[model samples]
Target chain A: MDDETRALIDALVADARESPADLARQTGLSAEEVEARLADLEESGVLRGYSAVVDWDRTDETGVEAVLEVNVELDRETAYDDVARRIAESPLVDTMRLVSGDYDFEVYVRAGSMGAVSRFVSEEVAPLPAVTSTVTHFAMETYKERGVLFDDGDDDDRLSVTP
Target chain B: MSDETGSEAADRSDGTAPPDPADSVEGSDQSDPAEASDPTGEGETTAGDRFTAADRVARVPPSGIRAFFEVAEAHDDVVSLGVGEPDFSAPWPARSAAVASLERGRTSYTANRGTAELRRAIAGRVERYGHAYDPDEEVLVTTGASEAVDLAFRAFVDPGDTVALPTPTYVSYEPGVTFAGGDPLAVPTYHEDDWALTPEALAEAGADEAEMLVLCYPNNPTGATMSADELDAVAAFCVDNDLLVVSDEIYAALTYDGDHESVATRPGMRERTVVINGFSKAYAMTGLRLGYALAPPGAIEAMTTVHQYGMLSAPTTAQHAAVAAIERCDDEVARMRREYDRRRRYLTARLRELGLAVAEPSGAFYAFPRVTDVAPDGDDEAFATDLLDEVGVAAVPGSAFGSGGAGHLRLSYATGMGELKEATRRLERYLDGR
Candidate 1:
């Protein structure tokens, strides 16, 4: 690869969230070169993660961010796709992740306000057939923002990739 | 974590609280924890892609200005200082000229290069800045400065061309470049230098093979102006590199310090610069949708031909009105500029009082103040949004203009002095609330 392609990959690693064309231009690389390197990196597990850079002010102002930990009551006949689709349609839910441990699913929601969060749970999530119970946790502060860490920071606090 | 067995997932068992659907998907996965279960049961086939559906309909999230407007939309009782649209009507002479054109039944399309009279007026106007153009060949009237901006990019840039921009500049520049299939290379201008784009930064951005240089002054978000000496240096650089300059001087007449400098005036520059200006800011005619571009004859021909195929012509009556605006609205322009100057002074003082790091804006109707002085870790987009939610006043985030906009908010003084004062009062209350 050329120097420009290397610089492009370095920038992409710095943020880990840039579009291929954007990374290419910033690093003075051709878009094709950037795309090829990105594909190689993805195949090798060098670029393993991508996440949103939340504008906390806009998010907090428009809605409240809540991590809803849900414990599902297991059943054979229950329609899981129908339930997931219902949650996905609601404007309040920003991201929904399936996690390990006691909770079956971790859902991140952003409501218009604290009141809106309660209303959304009561009106939308409550009506779903297969759901059992949920526990909500509000984020207090983001101590270290995503895509802003490098070698100087501790590996534990920073995001790392396994090759 | 409760280890609930299957068959307990039929309905809401916990009667006290509402059961969220997210739990049901989780419950199904847990029923067979060892075997991977697809929530959709199609094993990876969804009815429609969740990601694609969400991405297709995604909205440009509510900025501080938009959020405030939404609130004002619901509550008419709320005295809104929201949205930076100028409160003044198009000056009387321009309005009457438009009315006269309607009476005379001048509603049909004019030439794609615009009504000859208006094109002549634009040429005459540019001549004052020492940038002369051939009205018949080098000027093409667009729907507005917005269209001219897009046309300039479309005319000069091919796919993958890099267009250098100075930040905190116009919000529309980057998007316009993108629409024309060009990448925006935003060169950050420091607040300490009054947001001037220096020769060094310009040279660095231009070092690569690029098709266009997008310049706006007196700038939008920062309200910064480049002096004649600065303009000369930029013009020389463009000439040396054989790069086209897309100059957006919509706020040219609104300069407070002195006459606005046009880079097109420099030697061997007019042939390479497309000068974009409009009747919007100068005559308080934002709704009129009238603007024109003066480029080298060949580029103007291409742009005018594009207009012929795409737009046909600008509004007929607005073109007539624009002719009158250029001919007779000198006094009205001066008056509005004076009012804006007063508001600029008042806002600069208020920003300083609020402990914002700000320099006096020399041109345009905006004051870009650094909000980090009060909230060190404050995000421009976040702080501005929260400020609107808490207080009624609205301002755009600095980053909307370009990369150098972090930790800053752009306050437009285009409203009345009383409204500007009220906005400052609301900002103070918002600071205290935080």
Candidate 2:
């Protein structure tokens, strides 16, 4: 990406909800210029989409979060993409990525409870024809997410002095 | 104004020269003459009378910039664009480092020069600008770039010497020179030329007779920076005139259009130049009071001598934090610069849209817009005062800077986007009424 586009993406990454006028002000471009560039970015697929970074723990809908490592038997004809696509079809799968290590895919899964995750792994994941082994690591707490620190209290300790 | 023999005799007995009567008169004249005459006056004794301040101290006017801030502070809901400080807190790593230092009880004073680690970090950072200095011998940590500028004046300026400073610049340079017992010669740069300090202006400002020249790029108030070719010309002039150059690069990191060129990095200029920089603008560490000066060993030695006698060393905890800033906060600094650049562009464009003439500021977070078209009497201070009173939008009068600043107003974009937008809206309404 060009420097200007990269800068725009960086700003969006920092705060997705920033208005085009705000972005224009920050980037030294007019609102129209910012709108045009953003349209081009969206059309070119450089910008996938914008979404809210919800703190799930703050809401009633939070579920058990776990990272699942799956070793899958690769098909000589279809390869890993087919298996990855099948696993991604499950609503419990939050994110999935093919891997290069012992595990063929690493997936993030969320469910109502630990029991539900265990049931899904045993009843659905383990029975897959391509699945070889599976390991699950449950997340305890999130210290940071999407660049925002969660627990650090806002206290400025620097001495207050005139410049 | 007393040169009474009783005082002079007392001074002479101590083998000190008699105080100049003319200087005493000039010193006492700034205050109420009645108070100076009456020792038993109810009012508090002024510092000038209590201590023997140099005559120049009395001549130095209180910073006009501070007066506007005081007026802004008196009102509620004022969207102040007068302050020169950044609104963002210091980056997390730098602040966390200070907390860690405090938790570890590392609070004692550091070496007279500074902590070795911080000096090393400063040396490494400045090297990117193509200047080199040995951390041990050539770097001295200071209490912000303010102290560095003061130390430079104290070390180099002698009585009756002249210090030539470009006009519409930061307010501190002139006073620093005056306090050091040197004459401050104003070099005028025109807004027509984007306030660029031309070689012709330098010569006209009496650079030949001046013992030192103070150059602040990405300047305060004006927000002007010299190009590489411009700097080369200024460097050549300094070389030909054998003038010591004290270049304040505090705003060096804030330049938007191009890389900042330090005069010290110029060929044949390093030996005679002292570079002043700090963590304030770049890392948002203004409250930490951490800055440093990079100069040749001889000049550093002289500044260190004055520093040791006065400041001893910069705050130890702040020094530790500064090391963290220099070593780890490069990304944070860049992030803040981008934000400032955005604000600079917005503010400049908005001011121009309001029918004022504004030069696109290449650096710093301020826009100096000519206010004569809207000002009632073509007085910048009056214009700024009226704006604050009418619309609660506070800006600094350019006259507070120096010569060639009378027709402009300096508006800072260090505030948030919301406040800046509100301030511009209010300013537009106020100007429309005028």
Candidate 3:
């Protein structure tokens, strides 16, 4: 991407709620220019979509989160894709990606409770024909997520000056 | 030869041998020139009394902007909007290049005109404005745009010549001209007209008699800029009056809303213009002390001669850093400019919301807001002092700039957003309590 486009993307990444006018003012581009460039970015898949960075812990419907390492017996033709797709289709799965090292896939699963997560892993995930083994690690506390730091109190970014 | 002999006779009459030019020249190679010129204690004089400053130097007042910084520094908890400097550090590539240069022991001075690579880079950059300066003949690297201003004034302005300058400026041009033995004729630009310099104002300031006209776009203190058509009119006036133009585009890269149009790019202006720009404001490279002047060959030669005698050259390592900045830091500069723009809009909007009459600055990182509503006697200095004393939010009085700036305040938004917001809050509370 061109520098201007890259800057535009950076601005959006920093604050997705910035209006076209705000983006234009910030990027030194006209509103129309920002709009056109944004559309181009969307078309090129450089900008997928914008979503809220929710503090799930603050909400009443907070879910139990765990990281699952799945070692799969790859079907030589389809590789790990077939087993990975099966695991991704589950509702409890928040994120899934093929990983290197001993694990074939690293998956993030979230459920209403710890029991639900455990039940899903044991009953659903372990039953997958290609899934050879699975290891689950539950999250204790999230200190930071998606660049937002929780419980960061009294952090003053101002420089110390006498005046 | 007669004048030299006459002066020598006068010196001998005073019981001090006349300084033999040859001995003094050779003595300079072995010892201090001042000491060599007067080796005996008979001519012993206090350092301060030995050399008197020129009348023009005495005529110029101490910088009001610097005084404000001192005041700000003296007070604790002062949230200063007084400084014009950017809070951001210099971009990494520029800093890294300087570090690399130092590691490689590249500590000696470069060409007095600056490194060829930097000059060429500058030429490439300014080409966007449609002025293709021959880097070899037309560019001179300077300590900063400040030095460039001093050099341009000294180069073009003869003693007692007048240099027309717009008021509510960067606070250096007037003194720079005065120090160079020129009179600075203040051309008043009012907030009523958004502070843009008009041709009428130029004529009213007596441009006909003025040898030069100083222009600063994305102007400091006022944060005002002229449109291309507005600049065209000013150019026409300069052409009509046969005035050399010293255009300080130091803040050119920080211009918002539209592209900055250099006065030199206008018709009939190239031959008579000196464009001064620097890395400080644009790339956050203030401490690097690097800047340049783009002028015609004759003007460049004149400035270069002054530069050679005065500074020799800009810092060697900084020049290398500037090359990196010019080549690889456009994206970083653009990023910083965007941040400044965001702050500008926020501060302008917030200041207006607090009932201050602020001309939303179209360029630079300052908001020139009228604080007459808050000042008991409509005094900007009093208002600024009171603001600092009461709320600890520091801002520069408009009067510090010039008479035309008497009722306003130059609030720099170069600080972070959090500080700006807090400063605004303090200002609001201070105003409300008053």
Q: Judged by TM-score, which candidate is best?
A: 2
Q: Quote the TM-score that chain A achieves in each candidate.
A: 0.60, 0.85, 0.85
Which order, best to worst by TM-score? 2, 3, 1
What clash count goes with each model? Answer: 2, 1, 1
Q: lDDT (0-100) at residue B229 of candidate 1?
A: 88
Interface C-alpha RMSD after superposing true interface residues, each candidate, one decimal: 22.8, 13.0, 16.4
Question: DockQ winner among the candidates?
Answer: 2
Candidate 2 C-alpha lDDT tens digits along A7-39: 677668877887887677667667798899999
Docking class of 3: incorrect
lDDT of each residue in B1-434, candidate 1, tens digit only: 00010001112111221222112211222122322322323234345534221221121121222233333444422333333345567899999999999999998999888988888898898787777788999899987776777688777788788998887776555645665667778777889888887767877666335668888888877889889888887787778778788888888887877789888888988888888888777787765777788888899988877778878998899999998999998888876775666567667766776788886688877788998765536777677656655675666667755578888877777665556667788888877766
Write one digit per residue (lDDT tens) for candidate 3, span B85-186.
677778999999999999999999899999999999999988887879999999999887767877998888998899998887766667667667888899
TM-score of chain B alone in model 3: 0.88
Residue pairs in collision within model 2: A26-B342
TM per candidate = 0.61, 0.81, 0.74
Ranking of predictions according to lDDT: 2, 3, 1
Docking class of 2: incorrect
